[model samples]
Structure formats: structure tokens, C-alpha cells
Target: MSEVAENIKTTETVAVQPKKPAEPLLSKRRKRLMSDPLDEDNPITVQVLGICSALAVTTQMKPTLVMAIAVIFVIVFANLIISVLRNLIPNRVRIIVQLSVIASLVVLVDQVLKAYFFDVSKLLSVFVGLIITNCIVMGRLEAFAMGNKPYDSILDGLGSGLGYSWIILAVAFFRELFGSGAVFGFPVFESLGLAYENNGLMVNSIGAFLIIGLIIWAQRWRNGYVEHN
Candidate 1:
């Protein structure tokens, strides 16, 4: 009887001891992904990071959409490449490496845009190349992608890029409609006799500025970032 009791106690102890604790690796990875800068507080909408491009190519729908897609591709791929090579990059020269990766991808995107959408590409001109300077790309590398896994970094890049794209598209929609009387090159106000027909409010930079300002105002209002003065 004494031997049986001892055997039962030993078996219980072994069972409890073999039960493994939750791995910190996966939990840590998940936390990193969830806390990425994209969803919680987007640079474009919340911090209002890249408004330059928003005001530039937003005069037309096609150019705006093209710019959005290009930025998305550049940011995502750049983040992935940087994450993969993060370990090899010397701390002193990390910024240089990040810039190189972003510039290369931006150039690639520019070539593709020029080849396929020549007319729209011409309208975009230097602005497309300026994607390299957009803070969202660099911010992702420095903030989220540098220390995270490749998959999480990719998603963070994509989410940040898309967040920027959405705001730009929205601003462009308002600018194009009110400034030009057209949406995506389709004549909308003609039937209503409200069309400008030539060189309307939409084609000018001031219109973009005003529209972007109003957009920023609206966003701030909705998010309670700004109170009415």
C-alpha cells in the first residue's frame, strides 16, 4: 500500500512538471504585430505625416490612385527587405541602407508607372520619385519593421501605406470633384450645367491646398484632435 501511494504521488508530480509553460516567442511576436504603428495611430491620418503628395497628385483621380498603389508597393517591399537584412546592417549606417532600399524600390515603381501609364506618369513627374522622401516609408523601417519578424514587418508596411493611400484618395476625391467638375475623368456636373468645362478650380494648386486643409480639419474634428475655435 505504501509503495502504491508513493508511485501515484510520483506520477502526479511528473505530469505537472512536463506541462510546458507558454512560449514567450510567439506571444512576443504577436504583441509586436498588434502594436505596430499602422493601425493604432497612422502617420497620415493621425499624425498627418505625408501631406505633400496629397496636395500634389490629387488634382486628378488616376494619378492619385496610381500614386497610392506605388507607395503601397514601395513601402511593403522596402520593409520586407529591410527586415530581412536588419541583422547585417551596421548600426552606424542603418539609415543609409534603409534609404538605399527605399530609393531602389521607388525607382522601380517609377519605371513601371512610366512604361504603362505614360500620360498619368507625366502628370505625376517628380512627385513619384519623391515617394522615397515620404515619411511613412522611413518611419516604418525605423519604428516597427527594424526589430520585428519579416511577416509582421510586411503587414505593418502595408497597413501604413494603405492608411496614407486612403486619406490621399479621399482628399483627391474632394479636390477633383469641386475643382474640376469631374470624378476620375468622368464628367459628372455637365448634365446639371454646373461644370466648369475648362481650367476649373480642380486644376490649380490653391484648390488642393484648400481642400487638404479642410480635410485635415475634418479629420481632426472627427478624431477630437482639434476643437472648434
Candidate 2:
């Protein structure tokens, strides 16, 4: 009778043990992780990390879009891998491991571009390889991925990637539209049978600088973000 009673007590104790609550997939904190970079913490206009690529590849939308996609892949996967391995990584070699991970992903992206999208790859030239040294990718791995959980790191990566993507896309949009009167090489104005003169300024780096500056100003104005002087 005591054995049965003890068994019952054990079962009851086991049954009453509380389970940890599952975190919501898109908790308020997680949503902020995904949203903050798109506006207030933008990599390009706000953080000012990837201006060179913006200047170089954004003359045409096709190459710019390809670069954006490549970056998004690299950043997302790199964050996930690093976050998963964060604990196992030795502090002294963490930077080296992070670089190795980023380099491997960038090589994969570069090869895929070369194998299938050879023409765009050629257009991209060294730019795809240059992603290895991009500040945004390195910065995210160091800052967010090194400390956060895999899922949170991924959301941070997506946020930063999309933030970078839209800014370059916006710049490329204006540059392509005015520089060549096209969108994704569709030749929009040409299709409309309107003879749109390509703006020489929009075809040059000066054009990108001007557009980026205006965007920075406008975004800050809209968001009311101010530098602490």
C-alpha cells in the first residue's frame, strides 16, 4: 500500500512539474529585431557602412539586386551559423572563425553567380568577392550574432540585410530610372515610347552620393533620429 502511495505521489509530482513557456515566434522583442534596422538602424544611410558598393553596383538595377540577394544570404546564414556555434568558439579565435564562415558563404555565392548568372557575375566583377570585407556583414556577426540566440540572430540578420537591401535598391531605382530610363532593365520609358534622356549625373558616383545624402537627411527628418553631439 505504501509502495503504491509513493508511486502515486511520484506520478503526481511529475504531472505537476511546470513546463517552460514557448516563446512566441514573433514576439514584440523579435519584431523589433526585424524592424529596427529597416529604418532607425539602417546599414547604408544611417550606419554608413556600405557606401562603396552602393556607388559601384547601383548604376543598373540588375547587378544591384543580385548583390543585395547575395548579401542577404551571406548575412543570414553567417548569423545563424555563428549563433549556433557561439558557445563552442574560443574567444581568441572567434574573429577568425567568423571570417572563415563569412568567406565560405561569399565563395558559395560567388560561384553560383559565376556558374549560372555569368553575365551578371562579370558585371559584378570583384564586387561579389568584395562582400567578404563588407562592414555590415562583419559588424553584425561581431555585434549581434556573437551574443544572440540563433533565431534572434537570424531576425537581426534579416533586419540588417533588408535594411541594406532597400537603401541600395532605392538608390539603384533612382539611378537606373534616371540614368537609363529603366527598371530592372525593362526600359520603362522606352516601352512607353517616350524618349527619356539619361541623366549623366545619375550614371556617376556623384549621383549616388547626392541621392544617399538626401535619403539620409530625409530618413533622419522622418524618424527624428539625431546624432548625440
Candidate 3:
């Protein structure tokens, strides 16, 4: 009788075990985390951070695209690693910790670029290394990852990475198109049979200034982001 009753208790315990609840991958808040950086709260156009790389690496789509991928990878992974270590790190050393993590990731990216994309590595030169100092990466690590759960931190990083990516890419597209009469080294104007001269101004830094300025104005105007005193 004792054995039978013990087996009944064991059966009930197994039968009554509760399953873990499912969390939505893109809950309303998470979706906002993933998207808000693309435009409205854009790191480049809106917050006006990471402007140096925007002008420097955007002369052509090829190098610009490689740089974008590098940033996205670094930011996303850095956010994940930092968020995981957030609880254990000392507040006094947080900034140091963040920079160390960012610098480590940038080195990894630089090596990968050197290995597989040597030409782009040369084109990007110090700018890839300079990603260590990019405000967006550090700001996100300090702002969102420090306080958020791992998944939310990842989403925020993704949003910010993509936000920076598209803007520079747009600049690159125009610069390369007009500067070389080509897109990604393909002769677009020539292929289209359009009689176009290579715009010397477009290849220069001055052209990047003009392009970025126009983008800032256009984005703000379309979004109705007016500045008020």
C-alpha cells in the first residue's frame, strides 16, 4: 500500500508539471527597440553621432557596405556581451570595461577585414580602427545594454547599427554613382548610355559634406523634425 501510494504521488507530480510561458520575439516594446533607431531616433541624422565614418567611408558603396557590416557585427555582439556581464562589472570601471570590450571587437573586425577583404581594409584604413571611438557603440552599451535584458539590448544594437548603415550607404550610392559614373564598380551611366562626365567634386571630401548636409535636411524635413527654441 505504501509503495502504491508513493508511485501515485510521483505520477501526479510528473503530470502536474507546468510549462514555461512563451515570450513574443517582437513584442510592441521590442519592435520599438528594433526600429526606432532607423529614422526617428537615428544615430546619425537625428542624434548627430558617428558623423566621421559617415563622410570618410562613404565615397564608394563597396567599402561603405563592408564598413556597415563591420559596425553591425561589432555593436550587436558587444551589446550582447556587455549586457551579459552588466551585473558582474563594477560601476566605477564601467566605461573602461565598455571601451575594452569595444576595442577587442574592433580588433577582431579589423583582422577579418584584413584576411578576406584586404583592399577594403586599406580603403577603410584607420576608420575601421576608429570604430573603437564611435559614440553610438559606446552610448548604446552605456545607455541601453546596461539597464536592459539581453534580448532587448540586442534589438537596440541592431536598430542603431542599421540606422547608421542605411544613411552611409545612401551617401555612398550617390557619391560612387556620380563620382565614378558607376554603382558598386559597375558602369551604370555608361551601361545606360547616358552621356555623363565623372564629377570630380563628388570624389572629394567637399562632396561628402554636401551629400551628408542634404541628407540631414531631407530626413528632418520628411520626418517633420523641427527644432524649436
Report lDDT (Cα) of residue 42, candidate 1.
Answer: 58
Q: For each candidate in the order shown, give its overall lDDT on alpha carbons.
A: 0.76, 0.89, 0.88
Q: Rank the candidates by TM-score, best first.
A: 2, 3, 1
Ranked candidates, highest lDDT first: 2, 3, 1
Write the residue-wise lDDT of candidate 1 on 37-94 in tens digits: 3434656656667877877788878889999999989988998888777666788999
Q: Who is ahead in TM-score, 1 or 2?
A: 2
lDDT of 3 by residue, 1-229 (tens): 5643443343224324424454466778888897899989999988999998898888899999999999999999899888777776799999999999999999999999899989999999999999999999999999998876667788899999999999999999999999999989999999899999999998888888899899989988899999879
TM-score of each: 0.77, 0.89, 0.88
Report the C-alpha displacement of residue 147, candidate 2, in angstroms. 0.6
> Global CA lDDT of candidate 2, please?
0.89
Error of 3 at 93 (Å): 1.2
**Residue 102 in candidate 3 has what lDDT?**
98
Q: Which ten residues in a row have the lowest lDDT in candidate 2?
A: 9-18
